[model samples]
Target chain A: MSLLNDLTGAPPGLPPHALLLRLAAIGAVLAGTTCGFAYVGGWLSPGALTPARVIDRFEQVNGPHPGFRRNHAKGLCVEGRFAASGAGAALSKAGLFAAGRVTPVAGRLALAGGQPYAADAEATVRSLALRFTLPDGEEWRTGMNDIPVFPVRTPEAFYEQLLAAKPDLATGKPDPARLNGFFAAHPESAKAAALIKARTVTAGFADSTYRSLNAFRLVAADGRDTPVRFAFVPERAPSPETAGQAVQQDKNYLFDALAAELRQDALRWHLVATLGRPGDPTADATQPWPADRETADLGTLALTGSTPEAPGNCRDVNFDPLVLPLGIAPSDDPLLSARSAAYSQSFTRRAGEDKTPSAVAGAPPHGAAL
Target chain B: MTPSPRFNLPARLLHWSMAALILAMLLIGVAMVTSLADYHALVSLHRPLGILILVLALLRLANRRRHAPPPLPADLPMWQRRAAHASHVALYALMLAMPLVGWAMLSAARYPVALAGPLVLPPILPQSPVLYAGLRSVHTVLAYALFGLILAHLGAALLHALIRQDGVFSSMAPWRPRRAAPTLRPEG
Candidate 1:
């Protein structure tokens, strides 16, 4: 029989044994083709840039330092205790909320971007990242920002935003033409910009509210689940004297203000969890839940003490959102995983830098946090 | 007299409909990845269109099983005949696998497989980023392979029509004569 007969499933008149052999050959070909295609797409093809490369692009524009993060590089480290109220047990079984359990929390308050000495008075996003270590060795880490909504929905868009924000080398200023084009193309970002423009800038970190922005899942003991977002709303009233005040001229005014306030009184924030209803936009962190969504006050976070310098306890730690204790899981928000991946890449590169000793001090006092 | 060479009416209709849908899907898929401005809108169209293609593919498969395809010309070279048969099997396999992998990828990513608002398909795979990444790569590679095959199929159809003037091109064409032509080109 000809090759055509064998390929077309042993055409009429072929022997039974020959037909079986031809069938086997066809199967082999299909399997081989699939393997070949997978190998090429997954590894061989030069496409889908890695997270490390994306982080590198940012470092290229903003020169890298020996001990600074790709974003939120300038920060003050604080050591405190985060006592969980057992009230959260009804919503999630995470061990940290086992009522009255005080976890030694190490945290950092930083300005967004890679500039280690960026002025505190400049218009920028402020981040509050914390790590809570349980007795059983499990840790829950979270990095939150003051903004209610993130600028972009996906990691790819975030990388593009970084590229657009990079300052032109010759001018030493961010090119307006590039930023205008990016904003026009990605209109979802306008919501974040509008929020920044309309809001009254707070006086200090203690009074500012920080939002997790991404939705996460809370599983109960009965295996029931609820989607929720978290926020740290300050318990203290907005200082009447500082609210809506003109930008301070001193470069270290916010940090100095926080240190003075902490000395006089303890800082506290109500940890509130907002429950997501059906049809809530959980996938996109760029969108906020409806105003009428149900919410529960999970607990209170009290910052009782402050340090003069960057605390060594939190310096090496990365507050990856994916590092959660039992009963808490990441929602389908793509940004959650994207953040973890980018954070991991940043951690690895910085850790690598640490291996090579440089003239920079081994530990710079966590840059001025209370 | 021998019957006029052509696929059944049902088969012909399915072929044309699927051809149009698949081409449009390829274009939309490319546009979705390359441009973020149109990604959301293109994705909305892509999900429903994928389901439509899958349904048509299944219907076409069942029709093929019930109705015998017109035989290849007896005079065609053995290698060409083999190439034709192999490509047909590859095409059918890709048509069935593309939508399935797409649905599976979304399921792995913990995303709802919604065809339209309030019409969501149940998850076919457990949620895992590793699994999702693997399936996503497979889906993309399979798409490129399917596209190449479609182009080859179209080229072969045109060759039969313009160069060989063979009945093969007209076998699945929308219009076919009621009677066989008296001066038929015999197989080599």
Candidate 2:
């Protein structure tokens, strides 16, 4: 009956039964998709796997490092003064960031992952885990990774990735196909892999940038809440030789470099936070906020001195992000809670081992000196 | 043979274009889940392709609403006729649902849903790992359902052309004058 009916066309009638079937089809689709999603949500979350079990699995696969827990096993503990600027107070009323007030900072620097003996040259990620002890007895702790984005989005996915990366019994090396399959299914991993390949490795800890890679809610004194992700941007430029250089001058070059730098003068890093807009990601650690997002330089972190034995100070302290001050709180990011749980499990296991801290005999109290 | 009536040109164009896009999406989806070498390339391709399919599906729905399709043959069994209508409805629903689900899944996972630099879509839902995982599984399952429905649709079209010799196939693709005649018009 239409103008184009001269060509091939459907019959001119719409039977009531056909219309009813169409309506039923629409209902079925809506119900099916929603129910399917609900079923998946109900079954396959962190609830299906406990943090303790995941840690135990990690130990089973990697074999626990004797003195160190899970990640950043080889580290140098240092004492510092963190002076917050007026800008920091504007973002959060936390005492640690009060204008010009110095908070005692105890922190560690390490090669990423669990191998204590891994060389600087072999490391792909560097870590800067810190704990700021405020005068009011409140503490702000953060475990930062040099990599901008994480390899996976969720802790459950991370557990699966670790299990897949664990070495096979036959060859004593992880199966390449399994890792490949994991990567293929999880396309979010491509961002991290590409970044690792593209960015030039920093020669030492002094020049590297550490990204928190997790969003947190920062509430101001006036009760306005802003989601923020912060980064430790280095004041010193990286040496040209660091770019694509495979050879480390020595096995302990990073630690030696940081210690040497600290001995001369306090090393400074801008503690900056990127403010998140309304739709910014709060749950996923793998996602980086947009570059042009509003950012505030919260303060300066000055590394005053380093300790040869970090086990004395930082080893007992879990640098849990959830250990927030009054004005700062964990975002809904599942990784934040997951990390807190995992860190507790790790701390419990390591402390239970009853391994005595190999205290550097005659070393001065570093935090008190700072 | 009489010059059989066909769907309006806009409807035919939208049908074939969407058919090609959906098939490509299915194949790419399969390849992306299997091969690491192809994963990055396929994912990049998948995002833009998904958005295109979504846009075209909307346009097709609008067109279909204004221009009703030709009716089934009178001799067609009631069950088969009902199946034909239901499948089309399912296919259309999937075309609309898949892209939105993928976008929301990425949002929930806190990943950028972008086709290029500065082109990221706003998050459709808050970041929640549980929600992300669930949506991801739903997207995959629906994709498989879509793929199966497509195959059945193809089978029905062929049966109409070869055995029934009805003009149903021609209703959407009318360039070919005879049942077996070849033409520049692409087959779904």
Candidate 3:
């Protein structure tokens, strides 16, 4: 029996090569497992900005207001329909752009800030987010801002800007030196900021021209794609009342005006697409396409009613910018994925928090005719 | 009492197959959290594989109940025997709990548990962000625990096979060794 055990190379006394092989196998497994744990634990990859970290920074800067969006926390939901003109069919085959094709839309109009109750005069940025539920059930969601160009080209730059803009403890305002340092480091951001400062803030959400800052591709039947940037150009001209002076009386002036406007009459905006040329910048949102680029009027969006955001309302929706239909695809812009990730993270965080009923007064509850 | 010399074929088969599935699951789980480029692909794989693990673990539990594994050598220390049994219980618990927690987490987040095209499992819990967050943290913590337990299990198996040269390792081993030595060292 002992001779047979020796011949079969039994353990308790492994041959040198066999022992080495076994030890090496064990070592390899341990090393791989260690690396895997490190990677999953975020130790192996240091300084890598993840979606979680981005959301964390947002909460840090804004302070958490549970159950509300980390940004664009103040908003009232609107229901609308998009009436497509056949003119857009030439550029792309999206069903929403077919002649007289009307798609149901759930949307939100909001001022750009983390504070849900910030006074209207304090908000310079306005946002129009929409979700068009197509005939076949695929949804095309887009979140557009009033600015003609994005303030930052990439998410990292946006993070840097957030840090620089954080309120200093010594003074409630952002440190001017840090803000200047950020702008100096990112010239593109400085230029975009200058351009934004140059434009007059619209009196309210109804008159503001909300632009899809990022470029998207419109795919044709033959598989050809045309890079395009779009904007919702409001039919209503700026109200006679200037935003800062007229809305200062009400804290929820922007939402109040929007709700009142929708109550009296339907608000309308034309979906205009700017066809990009070969030399146009598709990835960088900060760079605007030339003014002379051909523009196509896709259709009109007629918002019929408003609803306060609640569980079953548009409040549950993430309004992820990357949720495109079959005919539209995201550009190679890095911000697209970054935005999607951050939005998903934000949605997850808010979805778990205590549900806060929409504070909009006199608006119908969720699902009440809106 | 003297026990059977080796585990039944069903136990061995389940053991080896589950070993492979679990190792793959751990690696895929790690990869899913780390890579955004392949996130969708990994998720598709993850959801199905997680369900499969759950089902196999159930079968494993049933098989274990029906067929008791071969006993350790009588000379083995009482503390080691208790530890071996406790770790095995822990392994089984995690195997069952991990998939269920993951399913509950997705359900809480209102994400469909798609088994295949057009086939989805119904939500096991209501949509609540607090519940989702809590379950998600538990899932992550349990995953690390499972991985650590597996490592310790592997180390113990190696110890038995190489150092103890006892039949404990060969009992559940897929293939039989050439020589059938019941206990190479009585001291062990």
**Docking quality tier of candidate 1?**
incorrect
Considering DockQ, which of the candidate structures 1 and 3 is the better prediction for this target?
Answer: 3
lDDT of 2 by residue, A8-41 (tens): 1222353445434544554565556445434433
Candidate 3 per-residue lDDT, tens place, B1-188, comes to 54467888888888899898888888778755644334445666788889999998998888878777876777666778899999999999999999999999877765556665334677799876678778888988999899999988987787667645678888888998789864554422
Q: Which candidate wins on lDDT?
A: 3
* DockQ, all candidates in order: 0.02, 0.02, 0.15
lDDT (Cα, 0-100) at B84 in candidate 3:
93
In model 2, the runs with Cα more than 4 Å from the true position are: A1-47, A167-174, A240-248, A356-370, B1-188
Model 3 backbone overlap count:
2
Chain A TM-score for each candidate, in the given order? Answer: 0.81, 0.80, 0.90
How does the DockQ of candidate 2 come out?
0.02
| DockQ, candidate 3, vs. native dimer | 0.15
Model 1 bad stretches (over 4 Å): A1-42, A167-173, A240-249, A308-312, A354-370, B1-188
**For candidate 2, lDDT tens digit of each residue in B7-112?**
7899888989888888778777754543322334566678889988999999999988887776666656678889999999999999999999988876665445
